[model samples]
Target: MKKTAYITGGSKGIGLGIAEALLKDGVNVAITARTQNDLNEAEKHLKTIGDAEVLVIKSDVRNLADEENAIQQVVDKWGQLDYCIANAGVGKFSSIDEMSEEDWNAVIDINVTGVFNTVKSAIPALKKSKGYIFTIASLAGTNYFEKGAAYNASKFAIVGFSQAIMLDLRSYDIKVTTIMPGSVATYFNGHTPTAADAWKIQPEDIGQMVVDLVHMNPRTLPSKVEVRPAVPPSARK
Candidate 1:
């Protein structure tokens, strides 16, 4: 039987890229996002890529019920799910004094709590299938900087949470990995990806990394991965 995967925030950027890669590998995929139009667009593009089936679901990861329904939908359409990616997140950059409570809540709620909701809802299926879980964290999770209070705190929590779950889930034969990346060339943080952004990591690059992880030997698990651009703008001559 073909394996199945679920990806949150799958309409574009890293999530879409991961969907494409998995489809190409003959994995049936169900992608979810908050926007119906974006899901529709991503569904159209995904259909063109691989022979495996594509299902687009409109959902918000912050809502546990929504994630539960989305996972049920995937199981209804496909018998088994082999992977679940908690990739829906947002970044709010500001210092402690300048950051508003609303902004802080949004970041923590979506980035941290959203991930918790996704994995919590998917745990049953993942345990049954001995599936894999990928939490898309960031280098900022470990390395903090100026003007990064909210984003940094959220990511740091994600890294810690993902690691703890890895230990908790491993006993059930489920694999959990946290991918921390830096300077990805995507629409993240409202920045447009143009030619000038070519030097940064591309979404597909992260997708390819996921593929590699999937194919890795079952005995060896890379619990956490840190990836970044080889030559950042600061390093360019």
Candidate 2:
């Protein structure tokens, strides 16, 4: 039987990296993004990487209705949902005083409430499949830094949220894990990946981490994974 996964914010970067890895393993994948063009491009590229059927949906994680409809469409097509990944997130770096209400809401809405919406919508199908849930958190979630107030708060909330849900879903044979990564090379925060970023953790590294999680023995559940580069930024100097 073929596995099926649904990922949010999968147009590019880490989410796309995960999608590519899953597709390479012949897992039917449905990826969601807020824009139609990004989904279109992702679908085209994803087709070339793997033979698994690809579904691209334009949906915003911040919108509960959109999240529900997207997951419903995936189940409607595949008849089952094995994994739901909440990889959609946003970051706005500014001092507490400099940040506007609009910016704060954007980060919190997409990072915290967005995961809530995705998981809530996916639970019915996930329960049926006894599926897995993966939340792409960050090292920032645990280690707070200056100017990271909003992003840190949101990710911190998700870390606690993921672990709590793990306990809740375990009785039904569902597994949940939050992956916290440090300094990954990706097009995040309006910066593009370049050769200088070779020292950082590559997005595909996290992708492979997800693949490994599924391959683990069913009796064993690793609830939280913290990944970082072999060398820190300071060490590179």
Please provide, for model 1 over 1-237, each residue's C-alpha lDDT reduced to its tens digit, 9 standing for 90 to 100. Answer: 999999999999999999999999999999999989999999999999979999999998889999999999998898778999999989888889999999999999999999999999999999999999999999999999999999999999999999999999999999999999999988898988999988989999999999999999999999999999999989989
Q: What lDDT does the true structure give each of the candidates?
A: 0.94, 0.94
Residues 78-149 of candidate 2 have per-residue lDDT tens digits of: 999999999999889999989999999999999999999999999999999999999999999899999999
Clash count for each candidate, listed in order shown:
0, 0
Identify the runs in model 1 with alpha carbons over 4 angstroms from their true place: none
TM-score of each candidate structure, all chains considered together: 0.99, 0.98
- Find the 10 residues in a row with the least total lDDT in model 2: 228-237
TM-score of candidate 1 against the unseen true structure: 0.99
Q: Note each model's CA RMSD in angstroms.
A: 0.7, 0.9
